[model samples]
Target: MGCGTSRPRLDDSDCNPATGSTRKSAAPITNITQSYQRARCSNTNPQRSRAIGRGGDAKPPSYEREDPRRPGQAVLNILKGGLALKREGTVNAFESCKHKRILVLIDDNHKMDRITKRAICSLASFILLIGHGYQCDMEFRWPGYNNNDSPKLGTAGSEMAKALQKLMDTKTWEDACEMIDANDKLQEVGLKTWVENQLKWKPSNDQFQFAEQYRHHLPGEAIRVANLKGNDTDEDLHRKLRVEARSIMAKHIAGWAANDIDRTHLMKLDTEARKKSERDQKLSSNLGFEYRKAMENYEREMHLGADGTPTLVILLVASPITKTEKDSIIDCQRNIMASLGTKVANGSRDAYAMQTVVFTKSMASANLKHFQDIDDAFKGHHDINDLTKVEETKFCKNGPSPELLAKIFNSNLSSIDKSELGERELYSQEILTDGKGDIQWPSHEDVMRTFRPDDGDSDSEG
Candidate 1:
């Protein structure tokens, strides 16, 4: 029979035509050999088939096989002109547009310089390309960014396009470093890695809420580096970013400390603020007409006016203790504030008051975001005793400065009675006291009475 055009083979038994390849004889082939053979065959296929099997390779299939784009070249062409680079290299170019924006996604751990260049270049190209082609938006997605497993683009296709335009135009490493270092999340995931990992994790509904809630607590640098797409196009966006970044860093650092330390710091901040406000409030009130009228009852208690301005001081405390115990401590502190409010008004003989009162909020918020930093301290099984040194130092550094206190007092002088003030105590007596009753000091009469306690009826009655 004549050779058929559809099928032709030299050996029917030994040759393997299963893959449409000419196998000289049946020989066990390794994986590498099989791959090479399949590629060779696919290349020799019809034009349509060849195009269909183009992206089969060891790395990601999206990488082109025959493209001439070199490493370090702008990948914008890939997104814009439907181009792909077969080689592995990084681009260090930057471009900008007058008013248009271009999205540039990259591996988060990629060098800041490189990312900056790509962003600038992409933006410039976007301005030019979109101007002529379509006047539309474009998105860039870096895979495996910020612990993300997949890829994502921005809603408006990367609002960072404009900011990047500015960054490239200015080319300020100092500014970039300042911003990056200030970021709380940047420290956690690292600068370039944030971008890459973000590719893996898409924003879910819950995750979006979570990010929004804690967004204010991150450092400016961290937020800028973490999410560059907050394109509000307002000057306040930068200010808000700066403030939020600082708050995030504070919260994160607090989390790194042990639960006790975290809780203590939170309590300290809240206590100090509340004390100042209470002092002002009680002082104001006392200085008011009501205090003037009530002071007639007690000359000693009449001097200072009541100050009742409410102040907000929130402290986030993370503790290793049971939640119930933490709640109890918080409750006790609140009760102290409540009790002090009454004592300030009634004029008990021994009723001494602080210009500011100690009211603490939970430290749970601060410690939650930065547990990794302080994990060692918390896990070492240290008790409250271990906290003395740290707390003392922290109190000295972070506690209200005498200058600030003076300012507050000076500002509210009308209500605050500075005359009765004495040496400041480091720890509140309220903290040490059990609050059940006053500690007793026995007298000589009591000593003799103990010996005379043999009177059964009298002793029983006592």
Candidate 2:
């Protein structure tokens, strides 16, 4: 909920869901891997449209939608079914009271006759108890096994103790009550005496006074009103009314305490909710700031100079690069520029400022050669080796080849700087002896004469 602001609508086809004719792959995509690949295409734009009869024979013909026979889809369906089975298994185990076994692991008996019957069929009996978290301790004894007489008692006791401990650690009274309420076999217990005892204690001393406030009903209050039977008298129904009132009150009280509900708890909850709201607001603000900051950084990366005038126009340049490749290349380029920061020769103040232009497919296609020239001037990212090393281990199951990548790079190089290279000198020669080399070296006088100004009449007057 506190994530970044919604981005502006770019285009219909740019979204993942909007991409046509793509099937969900078998292997799940890893977040780190996805991010790495995205670096290469960060500044590039998606290709507008596939060229007809070119670039892999104009998108393959649409096949009939595979039904229950589709390989990938079938695997996915099976996976979903497996997950469902696991959930069902967990529920079945709980209902059967499999958790009741082992000493000191008691379960609240449910009122449902069917559930208890099922548990009995499975040779399990749960002791009904109330309250939340670690409600009650149990001492379990197997039907055929004697705890005191058996030679394996110590081991059995230890195992049972550990099992119970684990169950109690995870189970709660609220969960127990919900489970018990689902059964019809268990009878509801009244809390009239318990409520009276609770009330007898001073409100100041009672730790659960806040919980009692909502739960404990005062004497003589009606639990529910209903039409009386024709033969039933007021006195006969009075006893029934009292039982119902106590049951209702007991249920409420049990629920409140079991859920850790109190005035203090409520106040704490309110405070937390308020803090979360404030945090969300702050997060939203931060996201806006980050977006602006990222844009500013991008601008500086593209523009070569600190001059405020925007040099690079935001364009829809076509990129053959995938998301993964884009992210990698961007990271590589960033690192390379950082390494060369001090070494790069700057003729003017503006020369040092460099901003990278993120382009879309349309922009790349509109002025492809010029952009390619610009790319060439930069000589491509030096970190191309890093990507190649990655490619050695990780192969794209479905993707364009590195040759295609190189082709895209070459094609885009024409759009960048137009320059020719001169023969590189390995080393400058030093004349140890004047006659050591056949090549004639310039004398000091010759060098001076070459640099001298032409003679003029004004110089003669001086």
Candidate 3:
């Protein structure tokens, strides 16, 4: 009997393969008091043997402590107030505390404003809303606005956030417009919309990247969308424009032409009409131009910039045609009308800080927030485009100037860019009424109050 004995094997199953002999078992009896004893190779566990690092095959893993946060996630957490980048404190409504943040979430990102963009995307900029101008801008926390979606990781989240914030700065409007114009990616999505025509873009917090990636190339065709957003915020000048256009066309075409000339044929006649006998053709050629400029001039005179001068932020033709023409002369010219409309809308924005939009159809702008749909929202105050002397005085209060109505019937509209208009081009959608948009829309007061509930409480004391 031995102190460390092994039971005898029934067969030579413990033979060493290398030596072709039975393996020797124990030298185990040597140190009886030792708690730690080295085991013989034969007694070593197979799993433990494999775990030991062998010559030139492998080595044990070595690890060092590190911060667990990803750069993007960390920056995002700070923005959402899940983590603290700045000192933690809570004070008044002026303070950029967690409680002060206003998280604005909209499932629909189709139409957005500049402030909405900043509030949603950029954490750094969202804090800057407080104390921007009139008072402290409450912090607006946009849902899912964390910087996890940047194209690049690491500093990309912070960098992208900063870039988004900077894009929306009041000082950056001109640069942003220019950038959108130059960058084909931006122009594809930006220029086609009502907002872009006014030199505005969606500078939202979270989805600017998504917009850039998926802003598929919309049909490059020209659209027939017109809006009259001008200094007359209280007036539905677009309806007036429609009435004016109808009046002008009706007046010119009453005895001038017997037949309804196809717009395409009329254009050909206008081009070839060097002969005096082609008087009707000549008049028709100038009809679109006349309509455009008269409306432009009307828009120009009615609206004023922040400095009291004419605002020329945008100059779109404000035509009321619903869509591209199969044959209608009415639907033929829409895109160029914006040249005047933009000025009106921009002036309103500059002078009054009002949000304005012009859509061909009431349905086109459905579900949009923070904007006044001039075409869909306001009704015409006058039946005819050429306002009566009394109506004119009532509309402007200071009275209409001779210079403003100078070119009601004539040539020389070279001041505007010609490229905006095209006979062959057409817009992607049609939502407005056929012919002049004479359908009765609601009053301006109701439309304005619909966008902001707090503004309509004039009857109630705070």
Candidate 4:
């Protein structure tokens, strides 16, 4: 209930949902990674956490965090305490729950009884570990079209890992920087400026080659997030961090993280409700009727206690998640089209609205540093195969290439050739013009025609 700054002790029984308990002796994450996690939770109560976050047509995240320290431990403690106390927060769409839209993942419409919630903090951890010089003892899995067809964290991880691996091969930060400066990869990538200017990464006094600020993620924490097969993500809690971490996140990842996390939480609530009623014999004719009813009950109760409970929908995705895929997910949610519901009949909406309130990491900390690099340095994050490369991969996925869609948009319906339009271009046209062969901007006459009052049926007539 109290989001205090006290963290879990090194020998404490940290609640790890993966193994059910953890024994890893950990430290305050040094920099970048650990700081990012703390930053995720700290933004939970703030009004402007996401004011400056991932953009360029990106959507806001769904879930939020409350704890200023260890997210996993904070949630476990709350679960240990109870869900009866207040945990209220907000996002762009959580209010839609009241309008009767229960957000669902509905992956490929495979009649999945299980819902998958995307933990952004979990994702941040996943993203943070890519090149932090630590190898996860487990395989971090992100399921795709199928198990074998899942997406990967892109070459950014291996790239960062390779760089850090070579860096760690050195005895100290100064030596590491020298090796990088003298290296071919540095020269080939032309990262000498980034290395010498952006990433000095001086070593900690403890003799580790890592930066004193490098918040080295715990190995157990890494593994817990790797395989998201269970409720391993600290659903009940979240993170926050220092300036450097906050600056990068604020300028970069926050928006997507919030949007995705909220969507994931709703997905989980639906799945859990179905699991609660999978054995019901009185299921209606609707395929997920029982699921709907179970969720209806959940909504009835959660909303009734809405005044007393804390609803958090915060997440930070930096893995195999992509702009193309993330957009599709939103279209499914906002009803632009049935991308995920292509096979399944989307004949009905959920019987309830989302009631969980998560304070989002939407706006960045208002008191951010006015550093030159903070704004343009991290924009390339949107392009990572998954967001893993810590040192930055391609120096912001900005260039002339991204403007092709806008170029396409400039063409009128009768102007461009249809057969040759690429898939993304097709999709862009689909949403904007709605596949109706024209992009319409309705005039006053159209609005009047749409909602014209029936003859003598107007209240004025009465």
Whole-model lDDT values for every prediction: 0.27, 0.25, 0.25, 0.25
Error of 3 at 434 (Å): 71
Error (Å) of candidate 2 at residue 170 is 51
Candidate 1 steric clashes: 66
Tens-digit lDDT string for candidate 4 (66-176): 332332332222212221222222221112222221211121122331111222222222122211111111122111111111123235433543553344234344564
TM-score of each model, paired residue for residue? 0.14, 0.14, 0.14, 0.17
- After superposition, the stretches of candidate 3 with alpha carbons farther than 4 Å from their true spots are 1-166, 170-172, 191-196, 199-228, 232-462
Candidate 2's displacement at residue 230, Å, is 93
Cα-based lDDT at residue 327, candidate 4? 41
Q: Which stretches of candidate 4 lie over 4 Å from their true place?
A: 1-151, 161-171, 181-183, 193-462
How many clashes show up in model 3?
Answer: 24
Ranking by lDDT: 1, 2, 4, 3
lDDT of 2 at 109: 18
Give candidate 1 regions above 4 Å deviation.
1-178, 181-186, 189-231, 248-462
Candidate 1, residues 305-338, lDDT tens digits: the string is 3422111111112122333433443344344434
Encode model 3's per-residue lDDT on 290-353: one tens digit a residue. 3343334344444544435321111111112232221132222133234545454422321211
lDDT of 3 at 68: 16
lDDT of 4: 0.25
